[model samples]
Target: MATEDDGVHTICPYCGVGCGLKLKPGEEDGDVSLQPWFDAPVNEGALCIKGGASPQVVNHEDRLTEPLIGDGDGEFRTATWDEALTLIVDELERLAETYGPGATGFFASSKVMNEENYLLQKLARRYGTNNVDNCTRMCHASTVYTLRQSLGAGAMTNSMADLEEHGEVFWVQGANPAEQHVIAHSNYFREATRDGATLIQVDPHANKTTRDADIHLQLEPGTDIPLLNVVLKTIINEELYDETFIEERTTGFDHLEATLEGFDMEEAAERCGVPLADIQEAARIYAEADNAAIFTGMGMSQHTCGVDNVQNEVNLALLTGNLGRPGTGVNPLRGQNNVQGTCDVGAMPNVLPGYLEVDDDEARESVEEVWGFDIPPEPGLTNVEVSNAIGDAIHGLYVMGENPVMSEPDALEVENRLNDLEFLVVQDIFMTETAEFADVVLPATSWAERGGTVTNTDRRVQRMRKVTDVPGNTRHDLEILCEVGTRLFGDGFDFDGPEDVFEELRDVCPIYHGMTYESIGYEGIQWPCYEEGDEGDQYLYQETFDTDDGLGVIRGVRHQDPKEVPDDEFPLVLTTARLEEHYNTGTMSTRSPTLRRKTPENFVDIHPADAEKRGIEDEDYVTLRSRRGEIVLEAHVTEDIKEGVVWTTPHFSDARANTLTNDVLDPLAKIPEYKAAAAEVEPV
Candidate 1:
């Protein structure tokens, strides 16, 4: 970011495409432009509305400048940096003394840079507790869990570049890339369609991405497992499955086959509300492809059965021998910039940094040698469990760069639990919904105000350069976490900056052994990269896996019905998602006039037939209710949504969908029932 330099080369802050950008810094104090870099390999001179407006978000007026402490009287007043930090430390220390370390919990931000996220997780571990989780727990934890169960690792098996070379069929389910991940959809859908590749889409609603689909299975919500099982049965019955691949490359097919013996195509068709012909067509299309890919979104991973949805997708891929090849694998498009990086850094509670399970003695010893502390051997509570346990025994909560009030499931329950905590500290760029519940809110810098490396959805690491000076008393999240940690644990916690933190992170996390700012340069290298001299492949697990036997372990996943199903009282299935205009929680996108203007408010999309049946018209104010809670939103009558179901974006404050979302979680992954919550909509 030199003054004399013509343009700054950087990566797009939005989506997994990780498009390279030529940024022209603001002339005075507030200006930004997207000068496309045509030579970039990922996205060549093209960006969605998000990528074009990313820089503008950095200089938004709503950016927090100074720390704010909630005066015991319920009002937040401005405070000095020293005052805020001291107050937070004193309260947290008091909480740790009164209650055990397990009583306190921490939640990291997915949008935070990799270095900052690494520090936040480290601070939690050093505090002698594993009650630390991130946005990934709610979003893609199931995807990671299922993939790791089936494949060797929890990442995209192929690179985006592979979409151009080898893709005969693209089965995109539960993902609508046209709105959220626009650039990725453009590259894969456009290229695959041009080459006459078959495109099969499975979703409750006919989303923007479904426009290019050759076959669209508009199935009933929460029936993903039944539909997927039908496809697998079709693959086996029609002799479309790859017998050789299933025999050599995978295990657990016998159990899966036995489970499918009872579930025939007709039963699945009845359950999923799709025609038998359509299900069979989709199965044939997928099985016939020489090279195929499965691209899923939050639609699959945000449900109580989120893990099972992803596990089925993987089973299909493995059965066809579509994995470990170019453009043929399961790709769960991540929402945030560093969600992959945050997970790779092991920011989750149950795992040490680098995804090494905390309970593993060998892994704990490795991290212990580096940090010189005996790591915890027990697995900690997940996010929802942590908040639920707050009032009873949990006394303190240290949240960094996360707004769980509007984001987490069962908002009312979360608010109640958070209010019961004795001490609560929040570090964020804004006084968000979650921060409003905090005793102390520490001001932190945004992405543009920091320099570090972030891993994208495809596991591609890229450098994030600091372009502007942090405003007022605000500081980077890494510096804040380090300061608080030093105060609590003494001077042993020493690090120069993000680079030093990254060096230690790489040393502990073997997947990132070869990555560094110097070696990666502007375009960060992909993980499992080994080092400079070693080669980086577009695909993983070509020959063997990183498991006990060095082979891919396919789990025999049993299909379980959703905890909540549509009944006489709640006859409609409600699905939650993000819009093209707003990112998660509307903290960033709502601040931008351009993006905000496009989506001024949130509205629920109901099928015209359903609306008419309920005597509701477009724009009619209605209350959508579930067992958790209820929310009032205007109705959007459209055919895009299937009958007996409704759709709404979860990025607005006025219509916080999480309020009505059930907190019942998957037994394995612990993800909430976000994809399909049985709720009835009534016109006011």
Candidate 2:
């Protein structure tokens, strides 16, 4: 909502910390300025570097002010909205009419509001296709899979505020909150640590979070399952397991016990490249803490064994009575602003709105009754699967605010696959790398020029107010989608605006049913608010799990090697992560002068020992290669990384980390193994 004097309240469009700020028009149109929202919820007026400089991109020199139509050969011409919309509608209709609904795929964006993504998925379904997905598949799909199976929900079990208030120990694995989530670390986690909460960090690279950790376990990449198994073995051997809680609130303990019956913890620690004694010490501290929380990240989720890696974390939490409490449970540090909400609103291939299974007859019928159409019973392709099917099953693509060209693993192949598409349409504020390949591009309004709601990392559904007028001829994402859907089907797309679309979304999404613009005032409401006046839950499963039997399911998982292991040809492990100043794929962050000045280009981090072995010096331009692709970038020889592990970020297009990353996916969640890949390096 707008403040008293021409300022509007909105959430930062960067990370999931959801810092609140106010925006006002400048001396001219398309210019914006930031004002601290002192009474805003979450960050309480705190603005990270990215949040403070977010307005820079609103008036970026590269903003797409009008629609454009390209001739499929790196050439484009300005076009009216009517001409662009008609071209898109005719192409989409022709594709489906000639091939099938399966011939098309939709990519929703985590940077967009929950309401916009909800409408996009609805349009895809109404057009008779289930091939829709978002960036969550690239980051936290495995975490969601394991959590929903074991503990029932697919999000953070406890909010940041509750974790700071009651948590005694913080077991952070595979995540760096200090860099990725600045406000969350500075305001909540750092304060919690200062107040006596023990911080245990487990990662292959020593990041900013490692500096603040009481214990840092720098293990080898792709060894999360083994490391966690060693910890579980230590907990069970010491008789520190919560016997009463396990017997009363959980099941399948025998399965977990039998799997580790003849376990060799020393061997597990050796595989993890850590000492057995240190694992035991960390396990004891975690098991003995009155309240402990586990933070999982891409390190745990972006592997071929991603599902198994996270399930072991669940086994640890359940074995030590960490579930069903205010300060405990396995939490995923979401990478994007609305990643949690994107999945919550059902912008995925296999689920309907509110995570309802598309194949479930009863649930599918309920949604069909509301939309006046029948949804396909079988699930469709995920993001990577859709990419693989570009020349075959998928002939057309519709991308909204997502850049798969830079974000996808083995991006060179994804870049090539775009050329094989019969049609490609991109709706975004700026012309991203992916948008350059589009047959038609729809110019959309910036975040400060749109009004909607976004769900934060902790499940709070907060509202974003429109603070400025849209630029030349640019329309809202919702408006562009409505025009396309109405132009094609001519029904179920007559919504006036985002607020009108949200009302229909509430009827289908049960978790967001109890919320409204008025009810979700300055302080947003958390999900699972089933009815009006409900305060919502700060932590889930206080008494019983959400599983069918009302008991948390305990399972056992063993270590599995990465899809590609370093051999003689490629004798080094390549790990990838993002920096504090950048967001995924460098769409909006690279345009910000503040963020670009801090991190102007991409670079690789190589340990001094490894650099010396290759006769390489610091700041040398290095050519890094994998079996798939190669990129040349500068190097930093430091002790921050392990001896055989080279780390890099995926923010720059010239040296995109995804170009050399493996495309092998986890079996269940289908997430690419971005954390570990067999690679080689040499002087450029």
Candidate 3:
């Protein structure tokens, strides 16, 4: 039914790697197939299992194809687009006028394109509310907040390509790229390892990524700060730190040194449950290398001390002079494809586009002048805070492409809060667990059926073209956003298409000023493209940092225990992880027949020692209970995890991991302590 010309060039919509993909029409009329783009700079013809199985979800039967309005009695009736939009406008206006703008909140999507996110945030601000946030609050809010505080920028300091080109050593912490970001692992990390770069993995579990590592320091859960502090002390005591770079390019080293003086290597080794020799060796390998990179993940950013953990990571990089150059810098592997772009476009509660604080009068006025609307000076609630504020400070909610009911910590509490909302709207491609609580559900097109730009983890901005038609009566996210915007705020939202929104975005967002769709040909350009015809910088801070003094700041960090520690009642530490076959919340991936067949249900990975202690055998049905709630899943006894720790994936709804995760928030980043929660397991 289609020819060669029908092939659409795009980027993978799964992870932050943002691998280039070629979408071709499949056997069916609207079906599509994915082909890896060899010429692409990021993936280089390599794709993970998730990327290969992406097409299976494009035509899934469960896709939401029509607007549905809930009848008070748990039934949904098909409604016209006009009917749904009118109801939404009326309810939003009623709530805003009755309870004031602060009573309503907007939750943007990290999966959607930059144009859509910009418009969604614009809609919130124009409606006289600053209550806007995204999924980043759940994943990398600490990384962004901490990096901006220490290095003056809140993004990956170096490119993925640099890992292979100039890297001599790699220090991976609290991440399993082999499962989460497979293409990046296969293409860059694997190549770096092959070329003699030493790979040191620091995690609570020995995973597939750690299998190939030169050394695996499998430490205790929630001991990131202590372990890293020991590494810093080793580098300092051995005189392996770059003194000249520290003196010239950084500040606050004196305070950092004072903090390190209090951390004893032997004590830290015992506290972290890792050998002192292993910690010293890993530190030596990193410090002695000519160039090294630090890669972190959600495992480091989802704790009560999340910001401190990232700050220490930054401290390690600054101390070793491993920044602002190829193969060297602090890099955080983002969880979502467009999460970096979503935050960049000002979906955050406290900032405008480009990380400009909303309280800053100049920045507020600049954005106000462009949109002809006064911006809110006060900051709003975060994702976790929004859930807590529902039924009290917040009443109405607008959620786009995010399923907080499944993804948020304490799943039962989130579900209860959603039900308590006076009014709720969910815009997504499928009927998600979160949508079940929505008063109205609007059908939205998937990534394969939409055209927009998404920024990758490496800050590369690439265009995603529409590969096929919308499945049914579903509308593009931009169309839904614009209709809502125009109806709510008179004429500011009248735009031709996504390009018009992007053009307007370029005018306001300094980081995206010089980029155009034409310039971003098949392979997209990285950000900080300040002018036309300028090739974006591959790595940042090569000459000067983005700080006021053009110097990296070393923030003094102290180690702290997790909010909830294991005790006699709950003797094991429970941690959440990802499965290679599934994506976050399992909305799209679980719907795919191929991925579902590969991983049909969730399982708790228990250490053999723990399993034996509990009389739990492999494949045994087990009940895992935490302080908040409990979940029942099959047991997977393995030595991959540590003795006192157990791991599980949060992909299946029947055995929802979030139900048992802790909701304790990090004081700074407001991220839930999803990494380390106290729990007890029993064989059923």
Candidate 4:
């Protein structure tokens, strides 16, 4: 029988597109069905495949229902909430007392809401440490570092509405929005292209985004800096730059010019495996357009020179003076739903709430005054640093909604390190691969069972309503964090619900200070809403940039090779990206029957020539090996990928691409080189 439709509105938790969703409860409890939320903001009722199948996991068979405590061995025994909470609190206190705050690491999750991440970071700082970070460190940490250094804000400079309405050209590089951010592509980008906006795509391998591209520049992987530098050179040589804007609104022009002095554009083009003429033309179109937007992704990040790679995009936007407007800016298409908010609320190692630097005495003091506790001033280790220091410095690990065992690079080593940790605690809704190793597992409510706020890729802060009742005995994530904070620290952690916690978050987070449940309404409000009556901005940096000098920073960057280059033994370059049907680590997506049937397991895309040489036919099971480890999976012989490069994704648990991904991080951003590696294929 058809149940009465009691529609509850929320945001799609799949991608950063933040498509609005309307959920209806069935006759039974926890039976939620997805309905198109017509006139709801963002995607306008259109849902992607991933978003449509999201409700399947709300009542999945694998849901974590109760608290669990690990025995002396690897086995686990079900325990009451009291027993589990006590063990976790005791272990955390003991670790801090014995090895100090430096011995513990806290990982916030991008999958969670802004309110939850804020509280987690606050708890970490209140407990006396800044050693906290999220999955952004693996994807867009470099983009954030570069954007913060150059433009004063690490998020997208333009909103999707403005980009669709005013954008004349879309210059996309290293990102596959059509495949990854499906809703964003379908509604905004694909619509914009049909209406006359030019689509210029630059990627190592052709994918969904390439189908709509007016210009597809398929350059080699790990060579983003070189390709972008060539575009910069063409703009400078042809005098295509906006001289007035460069002179008045930007700094460091001379440094850029000096770096590009006598630069050989032809040689750089050859090095990146892209035609020089195509790169130059793409540059000319972008520079000449009235409003051109740049969208970058993990292909530009996840390298030793990830910072430099993104800095060049900044250089492109600044030199051409395409920023400070409705549609023109460098927009990093974020991978996860709340990754942007995770950084904005200062869940990382370096920043406090509101992107305030931990080392800054004034910033630290301001936050301390509100929290009633003195925070650690020095910044601590990143996620990778914590992993590398697992046995030596970090004795305990706290994970929330993140499966680092499958998410982090060098997965085999990460698993071994996780096994040796003294104490491990995980708070999530499902029995994740990482949760199996936890000493104390705290079951938390799913997104459909909670209400909170999450900031999307375009800096739009929207509200998500609880669509159903909590499954089994699971508690809310906010409640779990609150209990831990109250039991351990004894003050500041007492919160009635999500609204109460959000009120406290607004008190310290300046960007969110003006927003409340009533204010955030259905349409949602873009941030930089500093005061109650102030309407949020549609685009940032209109008159002056947020840089210290109030001018856009312009600098040139040189190309750098991947840390692990292909050798005779490993003769193919292995690069990783996400698939349309799967989210990262396949934690929630794989559990859905529709998504599972669509793409059941991992597969590698290889050039026909390479597969032929390896005696591998289409759909043949192959062993893909790198310097670190190997995994067996089916191979598809195709020319979609370049001859020397092999492409796969990081979604499957049984066979993850991260097993072969190099862990050499970008020195400044601490992001791993998950995009490129050296590997070989053998028929299994």
Candidate 5:
């Protein structure tokens, strides 16, 4: 299957590369192609494997056109929109009557629009419960939590444009952005490396990003804190600390210096599986650099100690005075299109719009005034907690866009919980694996068929036009959300369109003051957007932070190991990640034949030696068993992974990698351990 036209100008739907793509419309009927954007701000002319085949998804046949309802016989049946909505409303009312608001939870999707995500959170809060969460919880919730705690801001400090001008080192850890955020990495690494910026990669896997690195430290998993601590100790011992910046901008040098005293190179070397020489070299190079930057992905923040891992990174940056400057701050390469926006608009259970806490009386009062309703004061359970509580107590769940059955850890348990639920309503563009268990499925429009705004990784809100019509009877997600909200609660939600929602959001969310649909026209406006003559700061904390004392506080952190460790029986550490061809859960990417053909099924990415020792060969069907469960897939033996570690992408339900992931979550972020788990791999 090939495409009809050469391409249409569009944005990449995969990573934060946000590459400009030329989408080739189907020529013969059901094919599409994509090419590089010659004039993109980020990617001038390039595409990753994900972006290269992004156009194929819009023309995918498996995209759902009709609503689906799970009949009593463990099978889904096509149903009209009205019928499905009616059934869901009836069941929701029943659940509301039987159990209180706590029994009902809502899980919004990151892959949707900012307006829809905002509305979903509004519905949850207005409905008198905080049982709301999103995909951010699984990815960068730890990064967000740690940044908010330490810096009083929960976003990337510098824009990707900062990667253009650099004179220092680029320290990339916990992510393979070269393959993931292809365009950004190409510019920063491939293009900028020629200009003299040293690249340092830190990860267990010898990924694409590591291959071309000036220095690649293959550290052990869950050793982020120890390694960072060792670096900090080296910097302190060798007088590499930024004295002036620490004296003026920061407040916790004495305590931090004292804390780093006990952590030596020998202890850290053994703990982190990095040589003392390499640790010292990395530290010296970073300290000596004119403008060093730290870029992190989910690898650093998807563990039981996820918050600590990120805090350590931030601590490292702040110690070296890498704040409130250009090309010198913590830059989190966000996992999804509006992960930053969703958090900005209050998708998390604990926070309101503009990262305001629900427990804060002032913030609660502000939202209450705008909505004209008394909002709840208590914080809510996270996504993982809601999943664990599904069968235990929760009666109904309204899932929008996300396919948790294929993505959540201990997925078999998640399926059982969904099966046990009194009612499960899923709203998505396709009949996803999670939707297969839904009592009612609402067909929603995709990115191409919807008109709204999405916040990019840099907090730059971009306009997404309705380039294509709704595939069938599928409606915009916001409309469905409003309809369901009106049916459930009364007159709280009365928005006409995405703009109306944005106006309301800006009114209540203080950081968005003076921001309007008109102001944010065509080119997006970053938040902290104020009126003319009231400049909006790009990097925060220039004058002071948003804390009670107007100063950022350094929360003490302790190094903790992962809950699941490699043992004799389960000798290999198995981690799950996304591929360039497929996104999370693969509800859209996998539907595309071209994308599907690139990587048809899930496979175990094992080291060559490990495969040989186990009598396994490339493309051999192998069974990877963890304490939670087991999954059989084809083995992809390569040197990309370490000897005792294996990797798999969690995009396929036929071979879900999450089924074998440990459900242990970070105590602070409540995010599950998707990166590291103990598993045994053998030929199936």
Candidate 6:
């Protein structure tokens, strides 16, 4: 058993909050428990249920203990590391030689550390393919795309501390932080609300978050743009916008003003299902506050018009001059723990590390010099695009810690496309739904068994120390990737440890240049730390925006209906939500006995009116069918949801919620419409 001196400090691997946790060895071997770290800046000694239970899954019996190679007949047998690596390298080589580098795609993990992600992307790029992406493609790709276009950066403009310290007003839209980011909500957001901040919540349901909101604008599903536009019109008409700030620090005012001409408040209220008075009051509360911030999530970015939704939010912030200051900026609460870091280190198809464009010759040359190799000049396919080009264009895939079958929209289509791949390799701790289709399943170390760093939503890079030895024959992600890269490309994959890979990453990613593990110390450092002895910037854009002219751009956006709308056959709209007790796909969280006892199964939440119409009662089994697929889940009759809408969480494997979600992609972001889908329900 570990003593007090044996405690190891690390960051939580669940959500983007990145709460600090201390692990002490439990009474049993390979078992550890989470202890609160009071000095952590983000959570300040607090942890959510998921974070507290994170250690429960580390030593679970179901963990993949060794590498498995699948035969042509759907049977998998244990294999040595040599056999598995050789098979992977040989298959990758065959695919590349047969169909060129572009035919292979690499899906990185957002759950791992920044160093691991950087190495994964480097390996993929060095192998001569830019078809690399991550789970962020489905979560916040729209937010990144829109924010970068308007403000010249794709990350959160302000720190979480800014909201608690300087925020006078909080506008939360399309997110339930109370359930999703429990520590952040309990420690910072709830504290802000208690401190007399005006909290305005805009969503389609009345849940735990809405209960705490000062004003709830429960609008119609997929009508965020109309309601937001009306608010912008109200602000402009009342002359509440920052005219001086706009004139001096922003551009495109005329174009934005022109787009608001035909936005009738009454029409918007009718379409959005919000009262005109409520809309006007929300606008005044946001515009009149001395300092206000807007927080959005997948609810705003998982639609056909996701980019437009984010662009409108950016315009709102720009018009009010709410950016470039503490407690006043566009903040997107990222879903995964290291999504911000994964993107920052260039796991996407378009950019190299530090948001450098892959197509740019100078950027390509900069990375090429550091790695001593030629890099790909062309931009690659996104996650959704790779799935769409499975059988014909793309043939092989290497997925790390992502369960596309349970997370991606149109589950049946994704499963079929994955099955059609010429060669598939999955590296994860558990035998997930996606792993069932893998030709080679490589066992990987869990968070407690690995030591590395993960960047949180606040852009804070914190270290996660290994608390236990790897179970059985499992290997760390860095070791596996370096070995595979060395075998495939023959050189430049040499690395002593995670810190060595991070040093190489710092050389390529300018944002993380001066940040070292030792420098991070107990309290982590936010990014944009350039030189030694320089502390990182807490909130970005203090003096000027990152744009070419140092001015923010305001883009006018219009409301667009979701790709799949309710019709005669499918009369209700289905949306997805998350459970506080469970994380995405239930890969790790479900293994916890405490979590499972709290939330054992998934259920479709239907309004009392809808449930009554279908003769369905609470706990009654029901069949929910969409054009794509169908599933059976228990019906939860509640008045919290709108009458025509239904909600469910995707954490349960037995009742997969993604089966009924839409796969229509946004033109710019390429994200699926996961929040809105046409469906119908019947009593089972």
Residue pairs in collision within model 6: none
Look at candidate 1 and tell me the lDDT of residue 19: 75
Which window of ten consecutive residues has the lowest lDDT sum in model 2?
1-10
Per-residue error for 618 in candidate 3, Å, reads 0.4
Q: Write the per-residue lDDT of candidate 6 for residues 1-684, one digit (tens) a residue.
A: 212374888888899999988898777657997787777778877988888888888899999999999985578999999999999999999998999989999999899888888988998899898999999998999999998888888999998898888998889989999999888788888899999988899999888898779999998889999999999999999999999889998999888889988778899899999999999999999999889999999899999899999988998999999988888899999888999999999999999999999999998999999999888899999998998899999999999989998889999999989979999999999999999999999999999988888999989988888888889999999999999999998898889999899888889998888988788877788988887666898788878898889989997888899988999999999999888899988999888999999989889889999999889999999999999989999999998899899999989888999999988999999999999999999999
* 46-108 per-residue lDDT for model 1 (tens digits): 888878788877777777888888965468999998888899888777777877678888888
Off by over 4 Å in 2: none
Candidate 3: residue 349 lDDT (0-100): 95
Model 6 stretches astray by more than 4 angstroms:
1-6, 27-29
Instruction: Report model 4's TM-score to 2 decimal places.
Output: 0.99
lDDT of 5 by residue, 538-613 (tens): 5656666565666455444567878988999999988877877788888877877777988999999999999999
Q: Candidate 5, clashing residue pairs?
A: 3-27, 3-31, 4-26, 4-27, 7-23, 7-24, 8-23
Q: Tell me how many residue pairs clash in candidate 5.
A: 7
Weakest lDDT window of 10 consecutive positions for candidate 6: 1-10
Better of 1 and 6 by lDDT: 6
Clashes of each: 1, 0, 0, 0, 7, 0
Q: List candidate 3 segments past 4 Å from native.
A: 1-6, 26-29
Global lDDT of each candidate: 0.81, 0.91, 0.90, 0.91, 0.79, 0.90
Candidate 3, residue 623: the lDDT equals 96
Cα miss at 61, model 4 (Å)?
Answer: 0.9
RMSD of 1: 1.9
What does candidate 4 score in Cα RMSD to the true structure?
A: 1.8
* Model 3 C-alpha lDDT per residue in residues 423-513, reported as the tens digit of each score: 9999999999999888999999988888899999999999988888887899998999899988987789888888889999988898888
